[model samples]
Target: SNYSEEPSRHPSLKINAKEPFNAEPPRQALVSSYVTPTEFFYKRNHGPIPVVDDIERYHVSVNGLIEKPKELFMKDILNLPKYNVTATLQCAGNRRTAMSKTRTVRGVGWDISALGNAIWGGAKLADVLELVGIPKLTSTTPAGGKHVEFVSIDRCKEENGGPYKASIPLSQATDPEADVLLAYEMNGETLNRDHGYPLRVVVPGVIGARSVKWLDSINIDSQECQGFFMQKDYKMFPPSVNWDNINWSTRRPQMDFPVQSAICSLEDVNVGRKGKIAIKGYAVSGGGRGIERVDISIDGGKTWMEASRYQKPGLEYIADEERSDKWAWVLFEAEADVHSNAEIVAKAVDTAANVQPENVEDIWNLRGILNTSWHRVHVQVRH
Candidate 1:
C-alpha cells in the first residue's frame, strides 16, 4: 500500500522493503558472523507495516478450541519468564530470482536478500500455551487433525482475490523444541513497526511467510487455515508444470524450509596473489535439524573440503531445549589456494544428513518456492 516511506538505511546494503524498510548487505558483508545486526538484516513484509504506538494497550488473543479463551496485553505477556533465542528467518522464496532466470515465476521477485539471522527475544509460545491450555484431540476427533492457525492484524488482498492470513501445523505450534514465540523484540531492542511492533509469531525452522506479523488471534483446528495465503498462495509445484499447465490444487503449500548454504565470498574478488582465500557464509536446515557440516568445492561438485564452523552461544529452541546446539545459522569458512579460473560451489549437510539438491532444475518448482540449490560462483586467481 504505502511504499513512499523512506526506510532506515544500512551502511552495507541496498534497501528492498522501503515502507517496512527491508534491506540486505552484499554477500561479502555476510561472511563475518552468525548474528546479523538488526540494521543489516533482511525484511520481508506482506502488507503495509502496522505501527503499534501503544504497548500497554496491545492485546493478543488465544482462542479457538480451548476451554478458557484468553486475551493477554503487553504487560501480562512480559510478566512471564522471559527467554531468548538466536534464530534465522528466511523467506520461502529467498532465492526466487535464481529460479526466475530459468523460467518466469510469480510472486515477490526476491533476490538472496530475503533472508537474515538475529537473536529473537520473547516469551516462548509453548509457555504461553501452557498457561492458557492447548486443546487435545479426543476419540471423537477426526482421523487426520491438521494445524493450529495464526492470523495477523495486518491484512492484504491475495492473488486468488481475497484477504490473506498465514498458519502452521498444530504439531509445530505445540512442540516445545519448535521455540515458536510471541516475539516483541529483535536483536535486543523493542520491535520496530515494520518488523511487527507489539507481537509477532516467530516460527523457527519454518518459512518466514508463516511467521505472521502484527499481534492478532491464534486458533487451533483440525483443518489448515482457509486463508488465501495458506490455501492458494505459497504452494510448490513440480518443475514439469509450466505456467500454462499449472494446477494450483495439485501443489502443496511450502511448510518446512529445506537444508541450504551459500558462499559469501569469491576467491577472485579480493584475495591476494599468494594467500588463503577465505570462503564464508551461513548454513541452516528447516524442521529444527541443526546443520552438521558445510562442504566447499573449487571445481563445482568435484573435490570437497569441510569448512570450519562458528556456533553461537544460547538456548536453541529448534534443536530441543535440552540440546545445546545452536538454531541460528552456522558461520562457516574454508581457505583454499587457487592459481586459475574455477567454478566454486558450496553445499551444506544437516544433522539429518539432508544435503542441498545438486542443481536448481532438479528441485525447481513452478512458483520458485524453496530454491535451495547449491550456491555457486565463478572466480579467477591472480598469478
Candidate 2:
C-alpha cells in the first residue's frame, strides 16, 4: 500500500481510498461545530506522506530571486512571531461527487465534507520574506517575479515520480492581508504527521493545493511553477472540451474559488410531525471575500428564507476583525416548516455578490475541479 507509513486515521471519517489516503467527515459531523476537531478534520493526500523521523532536524530552504538563500531549522521558526489564523482548508475536488452525477469527471469523488476550518499557529509568510532580506515586500519584485512557488517533500507517482508542487501570484503572496503562514501548530496543538507535522504553508482564501503540505522549499519565479500540478492539472475547462479535444494551456489554474455552500443536515425523515425542520450547513468564499448571506429553500428554489450566521461557539462574531477578512467559514441554520416531501436547497452570496450556480450541469467540467453549485437534499415527511 502506498500509505503504509501513514498514521492511523479517525474511524469516523468516510474513507474514500486506502492508499494516498483520502477521507472526509460525514455531513452531520462536519457542521456540528464551527471549528472542526483535528481528529475529525478531513484528510486529503495526493501522495505518500513523507516520513520525517526527526522533526528537529527538518529544515526548509528559501531561495530563488533572493539576495541570499537561507535554510531555517525548527529552532529558527519558533523564534519568529507566531500568528494564529482561523481559516478553512478545502480541497479543489470538494463536492466532485455531485458533479459526477451530471457528467463523467476525473478526480477524487469528494463530498462536501472535504473542507474544515481551524485555528492555525505559525509565522506569517510576508514577515518571513522580510526576515530573509526582502526589504520591500509590497513594492519590490524580486527579478520581476510574477509568482511564488512551493515544493513539497512527498513523492507522487502521478507526476511521473516527482514531489508535489504548486504556486500563487507574487502580488497575493506579498499582500500583508493574505495571512499566508508557515504553520507549525493546528487548533492549539502540534500538527500530527498526517497534517504536515513540522511545518506547512497555509495560503488563506486560496485553493488548498496552493497551501503545500510537507513544505520543502519556496521560490520566487518570473513565471508560474512548471510542475505538473501547476501546468497540466488543477486547471478548469469548459464542458465542450473533453478528453478527445482538450487544451490545458488555454485554461488558467484555479486560485480563488467561487462562493460555495452545502446542506450538512443528514437526517431526512421527520416521523409523525409536520412542523419546522432544522437545517444547518456551512458557506465560504475565496480571495478575502466574506459571505454576505445564505438563503435556504424548501421547495427547490421557489421561495427562499435567510439563515442566521454564526461564527465561533461562544462568540457570536469573530473577535479578531483583522483576521476575519476572509479566512474562516460561517455556519448557518434555519427552521422551516415542512408539510410534505420536498427538496431542501441552499445558495450563498459572497461579499463580492458572487452566487453559486443553480445546477451542477451549468458548472460541469472535465476534471471536476470546482463544483460549487447550490447544494440540495431531499426530505421525507413521514406520518
Whole-model Cα lDDT per candidate? 0.73, 0.83
Candidate 2, residue 32: the lDDT equals 81
Q: Which residue runs does candidate 2 get wrong by more than 4 Å?
A: 139-142, 267-273, 313-325
Q: Where does the lowest 10-residue lDDT sum fall in candidate 1?
A: 135-144
TM-score, each model? 0.88, 0.94
Q: What is the lDDT of residue 260 in candidate 1?
A: 84
- Which tens-of-lDDT digit does each residue in 350-376 have in candidate 2? 999999999888888989988998888
Give stretches of model 1 more than 4 Å off. 4-7, 17-22, 135-146, 159-164, 267-275, 314-325
Instruction: Score residue 248 of candidate 2 by CA lDDT.
Output: 80
As a whole number from 0 to 100, the lDDT of residue 265 in candidate 2 is 79
